[model samples]
Structures are given as structure tokens and as C-alpha cells.
Target: MSDPILRLEGIHTDIAQYHILHGVDLEVPRGAVTMLLGRNGVGKTTTLRTVIGHWQARAGRILFDGAEITGAKTPDRARMGIGYVPEDMGIFSDLTVEENMTLAAATGPLDPARRDRIFEAFPPLRTFWRSPAGTLSGGQKQMLTIARAMAEERRLYLIDEPTKGLAPAIVSTMAGALRDLKRQGASILLVEQNFAVAKALGDYAAVMDDGRIVWAGEMQELATDAGLQERLMGLSMEAQ
Candidate 1:
């Protein structure tokens, strides 16, 4: 396989007085989606934050595109081609959808080709082009968040719990959008709870528990092995 686009080695993090991530090691290969799966409070979000510098790593190295980025600021990481979509769907509530997209295109004005691609991936973005982001439904806002990340060319995407609280139809839409991204050769490190969505988009999978990775392998392997899934994640395909 080609070298990973992103790698985390012995990553440690703390939030307030509590240690969140402990010696977390992960690899996201180029041109594929790597699902970060775990029960809540296992430090999946913290791992993403540490990658983008939202939470500083207390120890260890973060290499992106073959260079160490452990000390890089969040904006520097963004400039280094890492796009992030936090779980909250970080859209500007008071701004128009167009404006939100424009802001996400940090390099310059929104490129027409990029805009076309984003709109094609999430059709609601076009329909609500001029509407305030707050006016959009939960699914539309989620689309906007992912679209904003796609506003510019990015080598890697760090997405957290994108399917949380969405209707099944919306989850299906989100799944399609991720598939579109994967087809375009975008590498993604996705933190997700919905096993069905994970099964659909993940090319590889990692299971975290108590802030450490306990299992790493092909997504299909985990999907088919009910005993493995039950042991690592406490859920089988039927439960999911």
C-alpha cells in the first residue's frame, strides 16, 4: 500500500484535569476512509482534535504528508490540506449558506469547479444557497458542513460523528456524499458511532476503548465477524 497520508504515533492528550487519549496510534492511508469506531467517551473526538491541534498532544508525533505536524497550529494544519468537520456541524448560523462556503475556501474565493462538485454532492446546498444556515434542517446543515470542508482541495478530512441525530434518510444521504468523496480519492479519518454508516464508507477500521486502539483491520473483516465486533465494540451487526 502507498504511505499513509496521516499517521499518529503514541498520541496522548488531556482535557482539563482528565487524561483523554493515551498512546493512541493510528494510520489513515492515502485515498481511503479509515473509520474510528468506539463507544462514547473513548477519546475518538479527542484524537481528531489532537490531529488538527484543537487539543494539543501531551506526547508523541503526528506526521502528515511525510512531515511532523505535532506542534503545528490548527490554522497551519488547515493550510497543510487537512479539512475538518466537527460533530456540531460548524456552520455560521447568522450567515447565508453561500457565505459559509466562501469562508471555508480559505485560499481564495470559492472556485467555480469546486462549488459545482460540492453542489453535486449535496444538492440541498444549492437550493439553500442564499438562505441563512440556521434556517436549514439538521440534514441540510450537515451537508453544508461537509460541503464547506470540500470548498477547497484537501488531502485529508477529519470528521466526527456526522450521522448523529439524523433521520435514516439523511444518514443515507451522508453515506452517499462520503462515497462520492472516496471516489474522488479523498482520504478520510472518520469518527462514527453508526455501525451501518461505518460499514458502508470505511475501507479500514479501528476500534478505540478507554482512549486506546484495541483492534485495527479491514472494514469487511470487522463487519462479518460478529464475535470480534461483540468483543471490541459490544455490538453485533444485528444490534447495530
Candidate 2:
């Protein structure tokens, strides 16, 4: 990992009575995708939320680009060039696709050239420009959420399960978009269950269990070693 762009040290977070993250320590390498892998209810989503300030950490620190941001508000974090694509696909359902895209461009209207390029990648967005976001299919809604984040250039993106609950074709499309995002030199902390996507996009991999990171290393190392995979995630990537 060449100088992590984001670091979480001893991060503890709780949602009411349920303690979700129990001291997560993880690092996202600069200009690379760091895959966050774990089973259900293991705090993968919570860790990403903590970094983005959606669910504040009860203890420990979160540093983004070398500045401690544990106490920063979500809007402030967003203004500081941190983008988040939530698991639920956070987009205004009532807003038109064009309207949703326009609102997320914090620096006023989006640049025309970049917008054109985004449209090229996700052509449905262009086709449904005037349609309400609520009318989009599940895959199209996912695309809208990712496109909303890409409406402007950000230093880092915290994406949670971008390929969840989609057909194989749509999953492949999502993977390609993420690959393109990586090609553009963007740092991504991705929480993915699909091992194939994780192995394909990740440069570094971190595995979490019981709200803490149990393993951290190169994705290739984890992908190839079935024993290590079983110990950390309780299943082989080959089987999944």
C-alpha cells in the first residue's frame, strides 16, 4: 500500500443498542481499490458508513488524506472530496435522472465533457434523462447512484456493494464501470461480496469478522490461498 489515502484506527461504532463496528483498523491504498470483504452482519457496511460520517464512530479516529475527520459532518466530508455510494443506492426517487445528476454536482452544473463521458459509459442515464428516478429498474437505479457520485471529480469514493442483487450482465457492467473508475486514478474503498469482482478490481484486500479487520494483504494472495480464505471468510473464493 503506497501511502494510504484513508485510514481508520480503532474505530468503534454503534447503532443504538447494537454495537456494529468494534474497533476497525483498515487502510485504503492511494489510487487503488481496497476490497472490504466479510459475511453478513460483520460491519463491512458500518465501516464504510463510519468513514463517510453517516453513522458516527463512538471511539477511535478516521483520517482522510492525512487529516483527522472523525468529527467532521457528512456534508463537510463530501465538500472535502469524499464521495459515497450507499448500499441502498441513495438517490432522490422523485427527481428526474437529469435533476438527480444536477443536484449532486456540488460545484454548480457538471462539466459538459465529463457528463458526455459518463453518458457514454451508462447509456441508460442518457436515455432516461427526463424520467423520474423511481421509474428506473434496479440496475438502472444502481447506475444512477454511481453516476451521481461521478458527476464531479472526487479524490476518494466509498462504495458499498455496487453489484448487489443484479443479473449477471448488469453485474458485469457494474464491474466494468468500477474498472474504468480505477483507470482514472481514483481511490476506492469497496465493500463487495462477489469474490470475482473483488479479485478483479482490488489491489489490496481487507477481511473483517465480528466488527474488526481480521486480515489485510494483497488481493492476489487472498484469492490464490484457499486456506487463508477459509480462515478469514469461512469459504473459498473458488467455491463462491
Candidate 3:
């Protein structure tokens, strides 16, 4: 197999003396979708933030496309083809959908072909192209956020909970968009809490507990191993 597009080894992070990520290790292979699963506060978001250089890691190393990026600045990483969409979706309420996308395109030249491809994958965004991002529904804003990242033509995309707080219908739509991105040969590192959604879209899955990965394997294997899911992800049918 080719070297991974992104990898984190022994990543330890501190948020003003409060340790968050504890020796977290993960990888997103080139052109594949990797899911990071964990309960709330288990460092999944922190891991993505650290990888994007928002929260500097106190220890360990992060590599992107075979170059060490542990110390890379946030803007430097963005220029190196890493795009991040946080749980809040990160869309500017004051900006129109098109404006938000144009801002993200600042990272790289916008390819008309790719822009059309993104629109083809997410027709809703095209419909709301002139509307303010804040005026859109939760799902529409989420699509715009991910679409903005796509506009950058980045090699890897880190998305935190793209499906959170949306209707089931919209979640399924976003899932299809993710599949389109995968088909376009873009690598994705998804931090998602919905087990069903994660298992549906991710090729590989890692379960994190207490800031440490407790299990990592093919998505099918993780989905089938109910015992491991319960132990690592705190999943239960009764709760669902």
C-alpha cells in the first residue's frame, strides 16, 4: 500500500495545562475514508484540531504526504492541502454561500471543473448559492462548509461531525456527498459520533476511549463486533 496521506503518532496535546490528547495515533490512507469514533470528550475533536495545527501538540509527530508537519503553522498546513471543517461547520454567517466558498478557494486556485463537480454532488448548495450561510438550514450550512473545503482542492479533508443535529434525511444526503468525494479520490478523516453513519461511510474505523485508541480495523469488523463497540464506544441498543 502507498504511504498514508496523513498520520499521527503518539500525539499529546495540552490546552493551557489541561491535557486533551494522550498519545493518540491515527492514519488516513490516501484516497480512503477513515473514521474516528468515540464518546463526547474522548479527544476525537482535539485530535483533528491538533492535526490542523489549531492546537499545537506538546509531543509526538504529524505527517502529511510524507513530510513531517508536527511544527507546521496553521496557514502552512492549509497551503499544504489540508482542509478542516469543525463541528460548528465554520461557515461565516455574514457571508453568502458563494462568498464562503470563494474564501476557501484562496488556499488554491479554483478549478471550474471541480467546482461543477462539487455542485453536482451537492445540488442544494447550488440552490442556496446566493443566500447567506447563516440563513440556511443546519443541513444546508453543513453542506456548504464541506463544499468550501472541497473547493480548496485539498488532498485531505478533516470533518468533525458533519451529520450532527440534522434531520435523518439530510444526514443521508451528506453521506452521499461523502461517497462522491471518495469517488473523486480525495482522502477523508471523519470524527463522527453516529455509529450508524460512520459505519455506513467509512472504510476503516478507530474507536477512541479516554483519549486513546482502543480498537482499529475495517469498518465491517468494528460494526460486527458489538462487544467492542459497547466497550469502546458506549453504544447500546436500549439507548438508541
Worst 10 residues of 3 by lDDT: 231-240
**Candidate 3 local lDDT, 1-240, one digit each (tens):** 458898889999999978988899887889989999878898989999999999999999999999999999999999998989999877899998888888888845667887788888788888988888899987888888889888866789999999989899989889998998888788999988787898789898888888888888888887777776777666752244
Alpha-carbon lDDT, every model: 0.92, 0.92, 0.86
Sorted by TM-score (best first), the order is: 1, 2, 3
Worst 10-residue lDDT window for candidate 1 reads 231-240
Alpha-carbon TM-score of each model against the true structure: 0.98, 0.97, 0.94
lDDT of 1 by residue, 59-146 (tens): 9999999999999999999999999999988899999999999999988999999899888888888999999999999989999999
lDDT score, candidate 2: 0.92
lDDT of 1 at 191: 92
- Per-residue lDDT, model 1, residue 142, is 94
The C-alpha RMSD in Å for every predicted model, in order, reads 1.0, 1.0, 1.7
Give stretches of model 3 more than 4 Å off. Answer: 107-109, 237-240
Better of 2 and 3 by lDDT: 2
